[model samples]
Target: ITVSNIHIKSDLAIGEEVMDSLAPFIVLKGQDINTLEGLSLRQLEEGIFFMVSPNLKKFSRLRSLDLQDCNIYLQEGKTRSRTIGRAIMVRTLSCFENLVRLDLSFNYLLGCLGEILDALKLPLEFLSLRNCDLNEDDLECLANSKHALSLQELNLSKICQFSIYDNDRISSNNLFKIVFCFKNVKLLNLAQNHFQDSSIPSFCEKLPQNLKKLQYLDIAGNVLTEDSTLQICKALAKVKTFQWFRLTCSNNLLDEALGHLNQAHENAVQAKQRICGLLSALGRTDIHIEIVKLSYAIFVDLMDVMEL
Candidate 1:
């Protein structure tokens, strides 16, 4: 059941009883619901702003909940610390005992990280908070979450304050901490966070030393440049579990793109047998590549596209 662009104007129009019989998966993206005044939706009106399904326990069988781009509004007022916000956030989420995947991406969920992580259950496999105005505190909460080990896929793309650079270092450190927590994660997405070449050295030092289970990684649109490409390759060399790695390093130095590719090829040669695919997945019409090594089966299929 997908419920996108839904409008719930009337209070308690959808009674608590209606939630008793819900499907395993419930998606409520781009919803325009005002207040959770009724339907048993949990509301914490204490000087802080936060809200969530209070009656989610009723949907005991629900395994997945998606609230992407819902534009959820918090009650107005400034809270001194994250304690109250975390408590309220936890209260809203703790009821979903059976949830395996939860996506709250593209929401205005500011400063609600401590509670969200504190409230998260241990059964979750996939968790995404993309573009949710997350801060370093949220990443810290995740790094300390009890369910971190259970997560298979984690998405933190575009989580930084794009307009400011004051908190970039803190956020980057917090992100690396969170990454270290989920040792068993299979797929990770950290795209478009603007962690430029300067952060590569830290990435090399903090990134999980050995993620044997990691398969797919997407670090595209991270403002990575040709000079940083080799640093990235060197860092990735530690992640021996990589199977399919997609990178988008364009627009910064098209002339030096081939040099970066050659360096990548040299680095990739070390893991040629382990890597099933290594795509420089970008949207460039002018760029081209030659079949430098036909024996490397991964590049065989991509050979045809190299000319165009």
Candidate 2:
């Protein structure tokens, strides 16, 4: 069975027949592809309806599984009492030993990172568990996974579990678990969380230096301050491989520190120009100009104090 561009409803009996047909490729849009067997299933917006039966090993040939935007529900009336989708149960995932990429993002998943970690058996290169209700244990489990060691991009953003008044229990700077768990991650996104200034320095000091391959870092929508910003800059400067740094404190107080930072940058530039002129006089104008350009770019891109 080589069907393309198909739609499946909640009818389970018909879906079972299609799964047993030994199809090589199956595409289900707005339908649950959970019934299809012996094919590479591509599920688009069908994540909400996915319900893994205990006997999921029938699809032994499934290589690529995409379940984006699935809704996962916790036990009824547990936390938010809403339909949330998380990674399928560990028992169901154990059946797919050939999977390469598993995208379980934009779901209503709760704390089930351990189950997800146990289910990953293949050489997965990309995994997205974004917006899931993750905690310290979840971070630890992922960091310890053998499959995760080879991952190039990992997105674990928006994993908060605190109401406005519950800030005291949730430390804004909960970076220890993350830094230790994803020590080898190349791209990390920690946007829209409860990070604070006091918690920033510890994160900066303990960040994995082995993350030299790290290219992108996003810590936006938190409560970072000038002191925290300086610590971050210092930490970033130590990592020679970092290319893009995005720090978002949109609603925080970062205005007063801007003038001081600007003045420091200007002084550094003036000193560099004097040294570059000396080098140019010694017939090394090309090297001097390249260094100057790099420095200027860093100065321009560093954090600018935003008015409250």
Candidate 3:
């Protein structure tokens, strides 16, 4: 079961009786009854959370866990309780033997990726650490971790957002190298990141070669230049495993991109058509050849802005 926005202050929130009631569904000896694969505990804070770690371990057969925005961290102090709290957190997470999907998004976990990766014996198939205050070290650790080989879907979206200066962006450093490690990944979201204005030449060259299995790629709000667009289309055409890969062309992007669509409708359409033509020419599979998808919102936005 999933619980969210729960300010679990006291032991009564997830008391023993509640835990005991879940036994027939998760633990009792029957194939249908014991099929619980996921448990979500969003916003389950640390204070009373530690008291129930042992009870959570009963969910050993769980294959998915969502602890998004849970503040699953030890408070800073040199006290024995803090150390014990961190250890308990790790130990509890480590007990889930079959876990394949984990969403720790918006957790603000600082310098703790390595410890968590080390604890997870089984490799995760899907992981989302969006807006987690991630750094270069975390990406490096993930690239080198056992999870790297197994990860099929990864969301590192908006991890570097709201920066005062794009000059200090991670893409200018070893971040691309870390990206190269996800050779088997299918769905990869690197949206809303600061791509150095000179552009990701390395991304266009290496992305298709590195992420061969990639089906869906969301590079939506990176302020992509025309050259970057052409290059990305070329790169995407190289990966030939998936059915129909969309280059979104955004017809629009998120809120950030939607605002700009009104002024540049003609240019955007031409650009979108150009990309479709390029993909059609490159031809991973047979296409009708006139492939440009403009969402209804974009169509209406264009009509509103267009002069009669």
Candidate 4:
């Protein structure tokens, strides 16, 4: 059953009852229940979470759940009647054993990730936790999750950074560990986070050796410099499977970083051309073939970062 962009306030209860009776894959989005009609995003999210908590068990055959931009939270200092904790959601989620895709992005779920991960039983293929204020504890749970090896696409973009002094914020080392979990990940989005130049070395160091399956990588809108860019380029040079790479790096030093990249590209192309010319003049057909292979390798390295 699919429902979207509707006013279901008057019959909300009845609708949920009917939905509970039928164990179908349910989709609810942009809904305006009567009690939640004029509420703010956060309030609406709370309302939806509460409304769905009691009925999640009814959807035994649920396969996909998308609750993006709902601002769900594990509100504290409230009774069970007023608030739903992450554990409850996790327990409820585990009931959907056949679930494959789960999207709870654009929410404010800070902490409680350990509990959630402990309860996850679904073999999810696509998971989006973008802009959810994820922390180091969350990263730890995700790193050890069984689903990590199976997920083909993982989105952690715009995860809140709180503050530089915040102890719970995810660091470069934590990010590396989280990244190390996925062996078959083809697409990874880490845009709009607090990654910086200091984080580049660790990230490069911990990057998996067998990333030939990766096709798209987005590390845009972070704090980076020319050195950081070079480090990323060097790291990417090791992976020959990428088709698209985007690093907006819209920080203060973008121009300086870009200048360094342009110079590197120029030097690399010139050196390759010179080598190719030398090989051709030697009348060495075998050497020419080797030079062509070398030039293609260099081209692949520059192509990914140059487009950014």
Specify the highest-TM-score model's number.
3
Estimate, for each residue in 47-108, the C-alpha lDDT of model 3 and write its tens digit.
43455567667667778877665666644346897667667878988988888888887675
lDDT string, candidate 2, 1-308, tens digits: 44323322222236557553222222232223454433223222233244343334555445555544434443323343222333335556777877766766655444466567676788566677755655555566676777556776776555664745453222445544555455566777665556767677667776636566666776655555545655665566556556665554323333424446575457446644654455445454433121122222223313221210
Give the alpha carbon lDDT tens digit for every residue of 34-89 in model 4.
Answer: 22211111213234554555555555555566655554675333577324566567
- The window of 10 residues in a row where model 1 has the poorest summed lDDT is 35-44
Worst-scoring 10-residue span by lDDT in model 2: 288-297
Candidate 4 ranges beyond 4 A from true positions: 1-44, 75-84, 208-210, 253-308
Q: Candidate 4 has which clashing residue pairs, if any?
A: 9-34
Better of 1 and 4 by lDDT: 4
Model 1 lDDT per residue over 123-219, tens place: 5788888767766766777777776788899888767655465653336545655676788888888765666567677776666474556766666
RMSD of each: 11.9, 10.8, 8.4, 11.4
lDDT of 2 at 224: 51
Better of 1 and 3 by TM-score: 3
Query: Candidate 4, which ten residues in sequence have the lowest lDDT sum?
Result: 34-43
Q: Which clashing pairs does model 1 show?
A: 42-54, 86-115
TM-score of 4: 0.63
Question: Which portions of model 3 miss their true places by more than 4 Å?
Answer: 1-33, 44-52, 74-82, 162-173, 197-199, 242-268, 285-308
User: How accurate locally, in lDDT, is each candidate?
Assistant: 0.53, 0.51, 0.63, 0.57
Residue 173 accuracy (lDDT) in model 1: 45
Top lDDT: which candidate number? 3
